[model samples]
Target chain A: MIQIEQISKSYNAHAALKQASFKVDRGELFGLIGPDGAGKTTLIRILMTLLLPDSGKAHIGQWDVVKDYRKIRQHVGYMPGNFSLYRDLTVEENLRFFASVFGTNIKTHYHLIKPIYEQIEPFKNRRAEKLSGGMKQKLALSCSLIHRPELLLLDEPTTGVDAVSRQEFWQMLGTMKEHGITVLVSTPYMEEADLCDRVALIQNGEILEVASPKNIVDHFSSHLYRIKGKERLGLINALRSLSLFTKVYPFGEYIHCTSDEAVEPVVISQQLGQLGMDEIVIEAALPGIEDRFIELMA
Target chain B: MDSIIIDQLTKKFGSFTAVDKVSLRIQKGEIFGLLGANGAGKTTLIKILTGLSGASSGKATVAGFDIHRHVEKVKMNIGYMSQKFSLYEDLTVRENIQLFGGIYGVSSDYIKTKTTLVLDQLGLQDSAKKLVKSLPLGWRQKLAFSVAIFHEPKIVFLDEPTSGVDPITRRQFWEMIYAAASQGITVLVTTHYMDEASYCDRIAIMNAGKMEALGSPGELKAAYQVDHIEDVFIHIVR
Candidate 1:
């Protein structure tokens, strides 16, 4: 439903987005996955018509982002990374205000946000500022959906949220997807990439890769290994010093070591095993979206 | 050898108990991870330990100073960095370093030397004069961390310091934490990134204002019969 063509934006000397281009199918859940300052926000703002692009063009559905800004704003729902609800107003008041701004009432589109709104309904009387981080986000999402916009844009909604809450937020997005809403979301978390139908990995104002999560992993050509040892830092240093591994970084319970050429697991085991380290385990592993992103950036 | 000790610490707001008699001990040169959901009293507990707020009951000592009786002393012994508040966006990179150094009561000469050291270490010597707002989020976060520990405090508390940062910068930030802990600095960190729990020497999962689980990452996983710390966290909080 959205199309971007060579969109470029810059702040003085720094380029926030450079020749960025992507497309989102109607009723599809598309993710713009990148770290902070990776131009995810800038791209979203350009599509939302809040910021003018320095060059190129973008369209939200049938309307051009620049020529039809008014129409785009009316049909697009945006939840900024920073919560933009009326902090001094109560939760109920914020929802009502957003609905009124769109020339509608809460009851007109109550079903659109029912799944998320009901979670924070008991705290309807609480001030927006007084709610917890998770609750505030839910409230923000509810307000964004109050008018039943066809397109939803969320910028890093789960960036700082805990695991369980992040999961719940994504589930809400899933419900929106099932409702045939075109959702364009951005996040710095790579694990969440799997939740999207397709994700474009952007970094340093560049769109490095775009594909389904499974396809991105399938494109990983290097031999990756999962190595675990008793000492974390020591093992990383040892692997880095070997010069044989293309990449080595800590990944949860183990260190992910990648090499262009396939190497035997026994070789790594024997090398670190001589360093007086105990309980060394090494196994060939599959690359995740994060590992692929690092490789693309490298 | 303990850098922090807590005995049934409780923080109550009216009839609500944000921290319900929570107890924990962190050793010198250890990387301790604090894992919890939002409003799980992690921030409240940190505030009490850092002397920003008072505890309703319980006893706690940070860096050998009692939090209740020697709040000022406790403040001097610890450093804190959170995602929401860290550095002045309007100030230059070097000025922020010097400003924090002055706040910690360091001498002008030491501040001058450390400022250069920090800029060089972070490879921001060219951007030292640039306002902190001009830097990328990753670079800004690294500078904030360096400034937080500029005074050489005995303990450092990081509350989701890498929340919105990328995977690569997040790892580099952890490298700095590893370096600091090796230098005899105690690090108490909270992160929403569950993979990070494995990086800590020990982790404590708090739920409903209480310490629900505390152990090494491996131990917690084994106890909960899960392969990942995220699973352990869900098992406790969910």
Candidate 2:
């Protein structure tokens, strides 16, 4: 379990955090969701003992992040967004390196990372930098989990990798959650929010919203519908041109339009039908977390 | 002007070809998204255009300068932010800005004025004096971006600059990018975020060292006849 109380941090005159507070229950895949400067990393760093908080405090289980920095590092596995393992070392070597860092041997926790580690076992002799992105990702994961820490702090672990690799990496995290590692992840992907147990949306050093992904969408203050039509760009233009819509964003094959008033589907049909747009299909749908966050920010 | 032109550009490391013979033209003032899976060669292609790495037996030009012949010119005309934060943690946030501006040959007076503008734009004017080490990751990322484009490069290469950043900040970062594009800066960014791909005027999907598809978000969707870019990728790769 993690308890954070009124944590605020500032470097020079800019405030990266402004008394932001949240807590994560044990076994929770708590997501710190925010934009570029929301202080997610600052908070993570403070909790990991990588940086000192200017004020406020956080407790990792019973250990204080500041007063007991050394102890907390033992219980947490942190995979920074860009921190790769030793590039010059082989896969086996990297695994050994990390295991030693936690005062354990790779054989001791080999079972924990076996499912992922096996994928790169053949390349065990290859240097880490020589492995594929997905392979490297797996290797990084194996290293972090080798010690079997109670808490896992991953900072944007899937930034530049391929989509499928990103998917696979998250799936691995999902499996890790079973061990109840008290996972805390920070990501800019709104789509990834659903994967978390609960997410706190942060912006400009402030918390905008915190709720389950579904709850966040349910809290959306507007009616949502997905509209598909011929000449999609023209249709988006037409819809955006409308004065009655609250938001008209292009979503995949259709444009998800939000309404201030419950506009009749038939009214849309009639209007587009008159414009020679009979191919239009409108479906009432739920708003996603990204949409809600955009709405909130707007 | 077609700001970027790559003809049969390929990059190989020993027996491994990171980027295949890829050719494409990116229009001026367009927000183009480079998308792919891990090890799909997006980063390698970016390196080639920026002249960070040499292409293997192919021609690549960025902003009308030959990548091989005019490497310095290429660097001068582009702002590049790697996937990593790439900021020296030892420097202060303001000092980092000044350092990058100096690298880009920004005049002292211009650096002062432009630094003020960028810091204000990113809402980091308050942390201008904070050491980069003490800054949060998200703030460090934004400051890194401002540093990359200090000289107002014609094209800015953002290699997942928003990675690990919060969703709200990601949106804000995109707004800043959108604003830059609106000002006629050609933006070529690489990201795995599918939603971010949707914001691009056009997108190029790469897989295993080859360009799988390239077009506007809607066009690629229509061509693949898929509902989402996620699905479109499935259709393409499958």
Candidate 3:
């Protein structure tokens, strides 16, 4: 439903997007995965026609982003990275206002936002500014869906939200996908990439890789290892000091270590033991999207 | 030594309790992690501890000063950095360091030395004169953290400091945290990232205004019979 071709945008000497190109298939849940200032927002804004790109072309369905900006606005719902709803307006009022802005009524599209809106419906009379962070996010999502656009563009919708809320937000998006609404969402969290049918990894305004999550992980050529023990920092430093491992970094309860050649867990255990680092747990591990992203970035 | 001590701390808004008699002690030079969902009262608790807001009941001490009886002393002894609250976007990096140093009452000479050290550590020597708004999010976060602890406060508070930052930068930020703790500065942090729980010396999980779990990551895992901290959190907060 969306096609972007060599789109680039720059401000002064810094390039926000350097010849970026990607596509979102019809009814596909595509993710733009990157950290802050990776041009995810710039790409989304260009597609929304809120900001004009310096070069290249983009289209939503049959209309060009520049030539038919008005037509595109009617078909895509955008929730910006920052909350953009009327702060003083009541939750219900915000939804109603957005519905009218698109020449539609809430009743006509109530089903589109019902799953998410109902979670905050009890506070429909509350002002947008008074709601908590999660509630405000749900309200903004409700407003965006109240218009029932064919496509949804979410910019870091789960960036600062907690895990539970982030999970629920993805579930809401899943429902949207089931209804044949195409989604193009951006997020800094690498774990969220698993939820998308396909994702484009971006960094410093450049696309690093594009593939399904499984495909991305499958391409991780090295055998990974999970190491955990006391003196977490010491363990990381010790592993880094060794020339045997290609990557050694802290990951949750354990350290994710990788090497260019196959290495046994017993070898790592013995090496650390000889260094006076005892009680270490070493095991073979599978690579996740985060591991793959870090490798690609490196 | 205990850097922070709390006894039956409680905060209320009208009839709703935002913090319910939460009590915990943190040792000096320790990385303590606070984990919670939204509306779980993590912010409320942090506010009470940071002296930005008061508790309706209970008692607490931060940085060896009573939070209620010595608000100014408490504020002076503690540092705070969050994704949304730190730094002046329009100001240049050097200007921000100077401004914060002045606010913290650090000696100008110390500020000068530390500023150079910080810029060197983050590889921002060339961009020190550039506006903070122009820096990438990772650099901004690193700079903000340095400014927070520049005064060498007894304790530092980081609220989701790595949120929205790249994975590599996030790990780099933790290295700084480890360095600070090694210097005998206590660190209290709140985050939504579950993996970060393992980085802490100890972690407390808050749910609905109450601390549902508190222990080291290994202990929590053993207690909950789970392999990952995220599983332990989900089990407690579900």
Candidate 4:
């Protein structure tokens, strides 16, 4: 369980966090969704007691982040944005080192890391540097859990990883949540936002909206339409030139067009036909977190 | 016209075979995408094509030059931008562009005119005099891409050029790629983002040094009975 109140941090002229406030329920999987330089890392560092906030307060289960830094470090597990493992050491050695640093042994927390560790146990003797990106991340997660911390903080864990590996890593985090460990993960991928129980969309050092993924999508106050045509570029240009549409963006094979009020699909089709677009298909659609985030930012 | 041709291309490092008997062709001005998990041989294959690594067996030709006998010629006809952007952080944006232009043997007078055009196109004219480190990640990526193709190479290779960028910026970057492709510049890109594969004219999914699937995004999704490219990727890789 973590609580943050009116936290504000700045470095020289740039303010990284401004009156940012949020809370994570006990055993909840919370996500910080935003782009780089959006203060996700700064906030996480503040909670880890690695950086002091300029103002306000934060607590991790009754222990103040400032005064009880040592205790908080002992009770928290952090995996930074970049993989931070002893490259020269073997996988097993790195795990042991982290366990020893926390005043514990691997055996003491074997059950806690069994699910994640077992995946990489076969390569225990291999050096960390030789492992693949996915393997290295799994090793990092294993080391973080070697101490059986109550809270886990992951910063952009799946940023550069492949789709399958990203799915597996999220599945691992889901298991950790079931084990009663409070999880807070940050990511730039908007699709992953739905996986968290609740997410805080932060941008430019401010919290835009904090809600469940479904609730966030439900709050989108505009009607969305998915439009597909043979000429992708022409379709985009035509849709953007339309005066009725508020926003038009390319989404995979189709363009997602939004309007301030409900509009008939036939009206859009007629406009595209006049623009010489071919094979036009228009259908009503639901907006996702990414669309909602863009709307809020706008 | 074919920009690239390969026959049973294979690369081995020690006892490990990084690329195993791979064969594919990229048409002129086509946007080709490579999707694979880490260590799945995507990098090894790209290195071989770009003349950064040697192939242990088989034959390949890039831009009409045999990769085995004419590696330098292959390099001359191709441009590459890695995930890291390959820009000097300490150098100002204009200085970095000038450095790359000089390396590519472009005339100084032409570099001046091209530099201004590129900056204006990316809307980075205001930041042209600033150090690359001071610019945002998205701007740096766009600049890196522009520099990679500054020499007007026949083919451009981009390796995860949109990694870590915001969604909006990533879309804008793709528009740049589209603009280049329309100008008859062939593109061979590798990315981990499955959603991006849809934008490519055609894509190949590699697994364990083997080409597992190859088709347009719609065709691949149809083959796998999925609605999205992400599902197609998961279905193939899993």
In terms of TM-score, how similar is model 1 to the real structure?
0.93
Global lDDT of each candidate: 0.90, 0.82, 0.90, 0.90
Instruction: Compare candidates 2 and 4 on lDDT and give the better one.
Output: 4
Model 3, residue A166: what's the lDDT?
Answer: 77
Per-residue lDDT, model 4, residue A180, is 92
For model 1, the chain A TM-score is 0.96
Model 1 lDDT tens row, A52-78: 999998988889999999999999999
Candidate 4 lDDT by residue in tens digits, A123-237: 9999999998889999999998888889999989998988988999999999986679999999988889989999999988999999999999999999999987766666788
lDDT of 1 by residue, B151-227 (tens): 99999999888877877887888878878888899999987678777888899999989999999998999999997
Task: Give the C-alpha lDDT of model 2.
Answer: 0.82
User: Candidate 4: TM-score?
Assistant: 0.95
For candidate 2, lDDT tens digit of each residue in A160-271? 6666777788888888777768889988777889888898988777877888888998999998888976555567667767665887776644678898778887787777
Candidate number that wins on DockQ, 2 or 3 = 3
Tell me the tens digit of each residue's lDDT in model 3 across A40-102.
Answer: 999999999999999999999988999999988998999999988999999999999999998
Q: Write the per-residue lDDT of candidate 3 for residues B71-136, one digit (tens) a residue.
A: 999999999999898999999999999999999998999999999998998899999999999888
lDDT (C-alpha) at residue A122 in model 3? 96
User: Which pairs of residues clash in candidate 4, taking residues 3 or more apart in a chain or in different chains?
Assistant: none
- Interface RMSD, candidates in the order listed: 1.8, 4.6, 1.8, 1.7
TM-score of chain A, all candidates = 0.96, 0.92, 0.96, 0.97
Better of 1 and 2 by DockQ: 1
Q: TM-score of candidate 1 restricted to chain B? A: 0.97
- How many backbone clashes are present in model 4? 0
